[model samples]
Target: MDQQRHTQKKLDNGNIHTSPKISTHLDIEVHGAQVYSHKVLEEFQEEVKYSIDTCKIRGFSEAGSLEVTTVRDANRDRNYQVTYCQDTFKATCSCRMLERKGIICRHVIWIYSSNGVKKIPELYVVNRWCKDEIRMKMFDYNGEATEDVDIIDGKQIAMSVMWSEIHKTVAMLMGKLKADVDNFSSVIREFKEKLSLYGSPMNKQQQLKKIFGCSASQDITILPPKQ
Candidate 1:
């Protein structure tokens, strides 16, 4: 149903509409205020370290049921007790800027200009979440490249692809990628055997780098610093 509506919208406007997305998340302060308001126009809900501005202007909340945490008071210089999302988030501050005017308070406005973003450091790797980790092979096969195609509902959907939805469709293409890998595994094994027989000059670290292109980080689990 959602997909149908999205398609219909695109057809009516003859344009692809971008979905609202939140900015990077910031850390929760141990003891301080947090705000998250920017100019309105229904951008994305950004989680940040301090109070913020409201982006919704017209009829935002019936009984002001709109519960977004980005509102702050300016004159009294405090925060608002905005509640949204079924108590997942709550704000309690003694700010007055938000009390009288039903407009976006100074608290929410502060976060807007803070140039702040959410601080979730570890990003979600689509490959990690999908069961297609080794499908890294999909990226390259012995340095050979291939093209990506779109398929939908057992039929090839021409030029219709969802960028992030790649993970969702993995179940369908997993078999094909795996088959190609299985068929090529022997070639990889044969190459390794030849290299071993010929006596390679590279060390273990070098080989690791060749396989996974990243410098290894410290393994705290294996070796804790001497206390």
Candidate 2:
């Protein structure tokens, strides 16, 4: 009986060593990286600003995040912001309104629900690496003819490839810039309309001619509309 008890005690002390380690080196290859975008972050900001219980919004442009605190009452002084992992999407807000019974918050959802990525400062378009589209289209072919050339293949046709690429990139950037300018112009027009309605400032057309030097009511003639 004593020997049986001793054997049991030895087993309890891990003398057999049958237990396994809690951690192990994973064989998985983790291509871990962060991706961020200002556009997405702006969307998050907009969403948070419209959410209930929000008292103030303080965003850091450098860090690419906004801290939104909630007020306990509309006419009170107390405020509380959500606490959650930005990457994990778990949050806690002042009001126990969201799912998880006061664990998740509205601000965090606003950040991600608006289209938040996993990284900071927009890693997808970071400019850290060379543009792949340019590389693929421009450098895809070496231009060296596979067959032997005697310098008499009708001037080699001289594939003007780089010029095409330059033109394309310029066109793309120009289109983007033009769209932004147009949007700005539209916003200005709306503001001018509001001002005119309130009788505080000149009309939209007048304001445009005054500030931008272009008549807001002018006709946009592309080839004069076929005359």
Candidate 3:
């Protein structure tokens, strides 16, 4: 038993590894390296630099939220509302750049920096925009033709291709489908027909279990649409 324990310990020690420290514009002096991708980090850094130079914290609410004013022109200053839930670390800005682009905006960057926040709050960093997304093998292609030799995972590559095609189809139909109620309902009905035609012969419960290794009854409860 002692020999077995020693062997296990040795194997564990061999597997132990540490990664290098990454410095970002948010906080280079401390533990601010969790931002993942350097491109996103650089953009945040640029915002921090701009905020330091031109942005100012105008006021704060009793709820611990802040108002930051970004000076675009001397005559036109943009006021951004920043709300940071201290308990949840969920931060949001009124600029809506983060909401639409999945990236935190300059206004929020200034607020975090001013508040002595060394590490970016995890809630503000969308995983989709991070460098780690590539590492995760979520999607492969970047909508570019390349001649470079690279080993591609077949599953991820196929999924990426499928999603690209779906996006194109959806974008083309977006305007016309939303033009009227009948158009929208017709499209949905057609999609349902196609799905039903191609769907598996197995019952919904069995199919769900076979595909996802979980029971539909336990994992999913289909509810009627709200009126």
Candidate 4:
């Protein structure tokens, strides 16, 4: 077990040390290094390298809101159509890589690079592949609310954190509890008793506040829709 753990630690350290060297494109290094997770970045870097080496733009055509560029792949001797929208900075490739796997294809990357796009567009950056989304904070170890009280209510954040922590703890122990039927029943009864300890039933407004982490009085700004 110790040797296995040592090997895993060494591999983790190696990935951390070599992650920065994965991206050869300046644009990817600048825009994606901080935003994407390590595995996603590595895949994206591979596409970027493929785009630079084997993909070439044959021709481009402009249609009202879309620009279609034809890219030829030298490796496969195939032509791919890339449609890009200047308004939203959204691009789609005939390869359907982004649609199928949530990773942008070499065809789209080549088109974007040829167009002198310096940064990866926000529309192409999926939330699931982002570093911040993967590392979401679900618990407060210091037993204190976040410092964003002025912008967002601290009580709401605290409630959200607590519920997340509770869910995580229950999930972690569920398999062990299921191994023994009597223990599982006892745990359920204890949970019911603990729940009853919170005296009165919450009103509809209070229940909504607890679940959503926001009151009706909070000024909620709805941003414009993504294209």
Candidate 3 lDDT, 102-179, residue by residue in tens: 766666666667667776666666776554443222221333333222455565588679779867766777657456
lDDT of each: 0.36, 0.39, 0.57, 0.75
User: Which lDDT tens digits does candidate 1 get at residues 179-225?
Assistant: 76565667668867887887766677766676688756766568667
- Candidate 2 lDDT over 74-119, as tens digits, reads 3344455654444544444655544433112334444444344332
lDDT by residue (tens digit), candidate 4, 1-227: 55965774565455456545545745854577767767778888888888888998888899998999989999879999999987877898889999887878888878777668878888778888876563233323333444422354667778889889868767767657556656656877998889888875668887777767887776669878999
**Largest TM-score belongs to which candidate?**
4
RMSD of 4: 13.7
Model 3 lDDT-worst window of ten: 134-143
User: What's the ranking of the predictions by TM-score, best on top?
Assistant: 4, 3, 2, 1
Which RMSD values do the candidates have, in order?
18.1, 29.6, 20.5, 13.7
Model 4 regions more than 4 Å off: 1-19, 134-227
Q: Higher lDDT: candidate 3 or 4?
A: 4
TM-score of each: 0.17, 0.19, 0.42, 0.52
- Given candidate 1, what's the lDDT at residue 25? 39
Q: Choose 3 or 4, whichever is better by TM-score.
A: 4
Q: Please list the residue runs of candidate 1 whose C-alpha ends up more than 4 Å from where it truly belongs after superposition.
A: 1-138, 149-210, 213-227
